[model samples]
Target: MTNFDKILEVAQKRQGQSQPLKLQDSTVLLEQIKNREQDTRPLNLKHIESLAESIAVLGLIEPLVLDNKARLLAGGHRLAAIQLLKEQQADKYLHHFPDNRIPIRMLPFDAESEPDLALQVEIAENEQRRDYTPNEVKAIAERLRTAGFIDVKGRPKKGQKPLMPALAVVIGKNLRTVQRYLEPNQNTEQEKSTTPVVLLKQASTKLKQWQKIEPKTPQEKALAKRLPELLNLIEDVLSNEK
Candidate 1:
């Protein structure tokens, strides 16, 4: 049997269950995998760094998802973070990941032939998730602090780093946002700003940044024309805030 066939057999045996595989062993298989282009989301460097930090603290809690053919269906950011950790030779995290092995969960579908299924999995993995509430996160941080993971000021104790940033990574939230949640007295104004309001503020910032650039391409010109209306609508909605 060929190498691919052997890998497939092993993956089939462990289907739906996570199994550790060495990074070096998967190097050739990584090249053969398909459907990577289907993931259109841009990689966030900060998120990757955050993942690396959390992985170092807690190890890999969620395994990377792969299809029957070893095609990555989700956890692209996680894979990148593991690669970063390996490259940095993070010795402190070595015990958690022996021999550079990472856990992977192989699905029972071929991503190349079942493109729609692959897309659905990708969307569900990335979007169909709820974040921890502010109070819930605060409780977790407090527990860690009480356990001596961090000092009273939330700074690292011994070699253990502040759990706030790591918790932010685990919950997929902004570090500053998580820190605010841990505050003894959270600002009422900030509490009033819901997820949609925060998203709109981010969009407004991006649009204003775009306004500073001169539109040269046809697409850019079209977007530039619509920018004013979009900005006006955002301002109108924000102004109506209670």
Candidate 2:
């Protein structure tokens, strides 16, 4: 079993709830879960848009999971997508929010008594998410290091170990991969500084190529549409750098 599954098993055992509990209110508004965004994962607009479109047609299959206080334990991105879909379809002839009510499984642990368990829940949820960008992996590793999580032997753990292996296990990456992401750039201080002239020239050439592509996918089409706006933003950044 995955670490997440193991942690979840432990949590279920502790709470004495073998079965999932549904949120009591049938008409619980999406606004109830709104304004709570302490999740670690950054919102990916493309992902959200795609998911929202899918859920609009098919409906939510997996119910959201939430802590006892109604704070979201998982499904922050899904919630955001639901909100997006609601707004987009507000003017549609037969549209309503994805459902008349959202379903959620309640987490039995009290946040104050089992704070560590609560954090484990968050970690478990994010573990099943999309692969982190290299930069994101780096930030995660740094955060883990800052939090003083190291192997029992005082070095990076071997193979696919848990908490001790830190981000590697959490993100399902190898120890070497995690270490590589954590490694400092070899670039010198002078080499690290970038000039917008360099960036502008690169952006200009890429923009030319991207402008030529017959975008087939929604993502490609979005990129094609945004390329000009991106160039303009680059120009602003370049001007500001001056």
Candidate 3:
């Protein structure tokens, strides 16, 4: 089973009731978070617009998951889309909030800490279904590392902490992969000063991956030739550090 499946299985086993719980917005949930609720995934305007349009037309088919207090543990953009849809439809509709109240499937974090549980819930959700991006994973990894979490072997670095196992699962990568971003050179003695080396390696690997072209094919050859320049340009633009 996928790592995500494992998490759901755990949840299902621990479930107080077979059916999921539901709550009203007026319900007071505990608030222990220090981080602002924003899209760490960085949704583009085009995507947001598309989502808003889709939600407005079809309604949000799935409810966003939340930690008891209605603090979003996930589905930032989706909630935004739903909000946008309701806002535009509000005049034609109701008093408080419009469309279907944006349905949700609650999975409360019984863990001690909000930060850890939030990351855990996010990871489990990602693993259970799908909605994680590499950038988002990287950002989470950076946060965990900053909080002094250590890798499996306990190697450490500045601005790099170990990700809790659950979040790594949602990323669909191993703890090591998460740690690679956390500390790309954690144990490497010879190459400690390599800046963005992991990114460089990923870029190189991507470029080399495009070399699998059929020489007899016209389009393949053209694509292959452009790969190097494409990689260079992308790297240059991305690495500007502006």
Counting only residues 3 or more apart in sequence or on different chains, how many pairs clash (N, Cα, C under 3 Å) in candidate 3? 5
Clash pairs (backbone) in predicted model 1: none
Give the Cα error of residue 102 in candidate 2, in Å: 0.5
The true-versus-predicted C-alpha distance at residue 206 of model 2, in Å, is: 55
In candidate 2, residue 223 scores what lDDT? 88
Write model 3 residue lDDT over 74-137, tens digit each, in one string.
6665666655655676642233234344456554544333465566666656556544444555
Better of 1 and 2 by lDDT: 1
Q: Taking the tens digit of each residue's C-alpha lDDT, what string does model 2 give over 10-66?
A: 767777877743333233457676434466667778567655654554455445666
- State which candidate, 1 or 3, has the greater TM-score: 1
lDDT of each: 0.67, 0.61, 0.52
TM-score of each: 0.49, 0.41, 0.37
Worst 10 residues of 3 by lDDT: 27-36
Instruction: Report how far off residue 13 is in candidate 3 (Å).
Output: 12
Candidate of highest TM-score: 1
lDDT per residue (tens digit) for residues 1-242 in model 1? 53333444554454543653322223223334343774669789978976776676567766776776778888888878877776675783566677556667666667777676666666766664456666777666665556444533645566665666667777767777777776766645456666677879989999899899999999999999999999999999988874
Q: List the residue pairs that clash in candidate 3.
A: 4-127, 29-69, 63-103, 145-161, 149-162
